[model samples]
Target: MPLSLYLLAVAVFAMGTSEFMLAGLLPAIAPDLDVTVGAAGTLTSAFAIGLVVGAPLTAVLARALPGRWSLLGSLLLFTAAHAAGAVAPDLPVLLATRVVAALAYAGFLAVALTTAAALVPADRKGRALAVLLSGTTAATVAGVPAGAALGSALGWRAVFWAVAALCLPAALGILTGVPARRTPQDAAERPAVRAEFAQLRNPRLMAVMLLAALVNAATFAGFTYLAPVVTGTAGLEESWVPVVLVLFGAGSFTGVTAAGRLSDRHPGPVLATGGALLLLGWPALALLAHRPAALLALVFVQGALSFAVGSTLVTRVLYEAAAAPTLAGACATAALNLGAATGPLAAATTLDTPAGDLGPFWLSTLLALSALLLAAPLHPALRGTGRTDAPG
Candidate 1:
């Protein structure tokens, strides 16, 4: 709720926009870089892979850096990467720049969580994380669209330049407005981090994460192929792509806010409800793809459900891993990126068949259903795991 929290969102917005802008720009980039579209597509996976590798690595290495300084440093890296990406002369250089930027992306998120959690009360931690993360969700709506337009009108390079511009101000905000807090250099949060991992290793926690991962895999797998699905299955024109994305983004923005608010009140109900929405929404989305209006509606619902669950899941992780909150937060970001990469690969493989795009959606639906089942059982475990290690 603080202005500082929105400043955190500024960082997330730039990161999210830069990460996803490549998706819309791949068609243009392939020609400019003299590579195949498939080759250009590698940038998305490259960024996610970087995130997966960087999240924990940043956590461990940045252990000695102050959260504020670390965040500022990461933003600087992100800005430099975006600038290099904009001016990249070849495919290899572009890909490398993306990876470099992605490292900053992962580090920024990891430290941002650390910074955000330190600003709020223990019980309010979940809400605090949600507020910070809402920027990412909002990027789905605002940043992605903006990037897509820039890519369409100006050039792919222009999109990167635009993203770079965002970084300077966000850096300034963190440097000025975001109050500094000190944390241990050795990961004093390590014990709590271990405890949180132990909690995740718990059967209930494992089940919940598995469910989330699977559902996530499903949603992304189908989602990765959404444009083709819409074109082939729904008979929609390519021009309608932005419209569809806008619909989903709107849903994401709404869902992220609602989940954050609800989790702050009753995380259990919020998690359970969001999980259930995914279970039902995926099937509806899959079945409805052929009908443009129907598919649009399903996309909206699916976005909301997926993001709502996301908000609740992060909150739950923070609650359960209260002591090692930063590590927990970093792990969550890592897992989500892992899903982003894996889900699309799985969907790409499945959609390669003649069965068309709906198959991935159906698969995602099943995964989401499993997650829904796990949400209720693990809801209580999250509450129990909070603050067990705090000083008496």
Candidate 2:
């Protein structure tokens, strides 16, 4: 892989940090902006709305500029949006900033996917995408926690300022390291815009995306409300929540990087085994969640399976939709955002039930099982790791 691919990871690290760290800062933001914590939570919704609304549009509009230039422009917009957010006078202004930043984030990620994959050889495409996504997993392990610490020490606004400042270097890296000329994926290699959208009608790609979304939904279902699970169900101290998160993050990072190396060589088994373990592991989690040790172990295991399998499914989507390079990235982005949004919403329904805190595990298990069943029939298509797209 090229040094420029790692530069893309740097940009992804900044954006991923901004995307998730806001959760930790919400309480401070709510009080500071004179809104309830629940009201401030709408900022996340605003971010989701931007991703859902902007993803396809970004894919459509990205062809207007060369790949590196598109990345540079989006990073600049993201930086500017966060800087505005840091000084917002009210929640509405902050909310608007979140939407704009998320839109830019979507654009950056869509371009990064194709750009990263294009920089590498056909055989290394899956790993290239994985390298870019490592920035997000790294954010899970370190960046968000650091942002939370920054929020605690300097205030939440300072966290935003820090994120904006970080993006400047990433943007500079893009400007300096990434190529201005378009790659095969973006320039001469692309199909017509109408042809790109036409891939949506392909059932193989659709099914793969469905599986990807379910896997992500299962991940979030178990993950989003984990503080409660760790403290409430596992009976661990609140202080242990961060430690559990680190375990999960470490496991996920290991899983994804491993997936990068293995996915192109063994896509089918990678997806199937991960999905099956998720199906089994979630039940074990629900049953033994009362045991602190069992809960901690399962948290790491589940996180590993979720990301390793989920990453494979994402690569499969690109393979199935290989003919539509631009739309492939956009579709992967949409599927992930869909799962992330729905997972917590689905698990939220079970919080007051007899399952209580353990419901997320049960729900995640079902979602994972559903995803695997969907993938079972599609295995043959996914198994083809080599390039399947025709010449330009």
Candidate 3:
């Protein structure tokens, strides 16, 4: 992997930290901002919605600009948004800042994906993408908890300020580390904007995007509601939440690492086996949520299966849309974020029902099956390296 890829991952780590840490900080933010916890929860939605809208829009807009420049600009925007958010005096202001920060996050990730894929040989695309996505796994492992702890210690605003402070070095590192010069991937440089849009018309690519989205929805639904299952269902102390989450994160890291090595050679088998295991995991989670030992073990196993499948799909999306390299990254980000936003929102509907915490598990099962069903026809498409020169 290139140093630039690691630098991009660092930036991604910063963004990913801000992305979901708000889930833990909501309790602190609600009273300070004078909103109900339910209303304060909209901040997470704002970020998710921003990501869905911003990724493709920003990538399309930045098509003519250098990738490094785009990365720097997004980081600056992200940092500024966080700084403003840290001082926001009202809920609406904080929500707006979240949206703006998410837009920046989407933009940075959109560019980062394509840039990372472009950094290596066609055969190594999956591994390259994994290197980039490892940042998110790392965020789940370390950054999210650290942000939550900081918020608990100082206040929610402290977490915002800390994220802002963290972005500065990442932005600087990216600006200096990412080279401006082009490579083989840039040879077809400057595909017309309309031509890029046309790539979206490809059925296989679009199908892959949808499959990726649905798979993400399943895992995130489970992830979003995990604390409840760990506490209310399994009867664990609230303090154990972070420990369990770390296990999930560690599992995710392992999943992505394994996928990096296997994805290029075995995309079909990886997706099929991972998806099946995840399909089986949700119901088992529902059954075992009461068994602390079983629940902990299941969380780790499910986490591994979830990302092993999710990362491979993301890698597939990038290659399948190689004809529109810039837009591919954005679409991948948009699709994946769309699921991130949707899963939690969907799972939330199941919460107040008799099913309670286990509702997300059932919902995840359905989502996982839907993703598998969608991928059923795309096996031929997923088999190749997806060279840019191939048919669009």
Candidate 4:
């Protein structure tokens, strides 16, 4: 892997910290923001909405710019958004900042994934993408827990400030390390809105995007409420939540690394296996929520499975949309964020019901099962040509 790949990972770590740290801080944020926990949770959805809207929009806007310049612009905007979030005066202000930050985050990720794949051989594309995604796993392990701890001790505002500080180095890394290069095709193929829109008509590509969305919905539905689930249902103290998150992150890191190596060879089987794991794991977690040891184990397992599916989802989209790799990457990001936005909104509705905390797990199980069913058709489409080059 090139140093640029790792630099992209650094940018992702900063963005991922901002994206996920809010989950752990929801409890603290609710009281300070004068809203219910469910309402505070909308912040996650708001960020997702930004991603849904921003990914393709940024793709269009930055298509004419150099990759390095595009990344730097997004990171600069992202860092400023975090700073604004740190000093937000009310819920609306804070939510606005989240939307802004997510826009930049989504754009950076789309560009980074495309750039990472471009830097490596076709055979190693999956691993290259995985290296970029490892930044998110690392953020979940280190950044999220630290944000949680900071929120517990200082306040949630401090966490935003910390995220802003982290982005400086990430921006500098991109500025110094990432090269400015475009493939011959990249230069010749100018941005065309109608052409990009037409790509959506491809059934296989659409199915891959839907699969990505479903997988994220399943994962985020349960995960958005993990702090409360662990403390209220799993019988753990608030302090232990970060520890469990670390464990989950560790599993995610392992899963992504493993999936990266396998997805290039067996994308279909890997996708099927991940979906099956989620279908099994979420239900088990729901049934065993009262048991702390079992709950802990299940969380780790679910995290691993969720991320394995994620890695494969990206790989499949890239493989199927090889001709429009950047736009396809943007579409994948948008699809996942759409699911991310919907998952917590659905979970919030469920929280208001009699089922309460356990509702999310069941919701996640259903989503995973839906994803599994979708995978059935995808295997045939991917059959012998899973490794074929996209038309340039």
Worst 10-residue lDDT window for candidate 1 reads: 383-392
Q: lDDT (CA) for every model shown? A: 0.72, 0.80, 0.84, 0.85
State every prediction's TM-score relative to the real structure: 0.87, 0.89, 0.92, 0.96
lDDT of 3 at 242: 72
Q: Which candidate order results from sorting by TM-score in descending order? A: 4, 3, 2, 1
lDDT of 3 by residue, 238-329 (tens): 66777777778888888998998888777878988898899999999998889999998998899899889889888888877887887989
Ranking by lDDT: 4, 3, 2, 1
Q: Candidate 2 on 336-357: residue-level lDDT in tens?
A: 8778767767776777789987
Better of 1 and 2 by TM-score: 2
Q: Per-residue alpha-carbon lDDT of model 1 for 1-392, expressed as tens digits? A: 67887799888988887766654566568789898655666677778778878987787567667777788888999999989988999988987998898889888888787668767776576677778877877777888767767777888899899999988988988887765656455455356545645555555444544555655566566555565666678998756665677677788778878876666557666666667767777778777789998999988888787877776666655555455555766766676777666666655555556666677787787667666665556655543343453211
Residue 365 in model 3: lDDT: 92
Point out the worst 10-residue segment of candidate 4 by lDDT. 383-392
User: In terms of lDDT, which candidate is strongest?
Assistant: 4
Those runs of model 1 whose alpha carbons end farther than 4 Å from true positions after fitting are: 30-40, 89-92, 180-208, 230-232, 373-379, 382-392
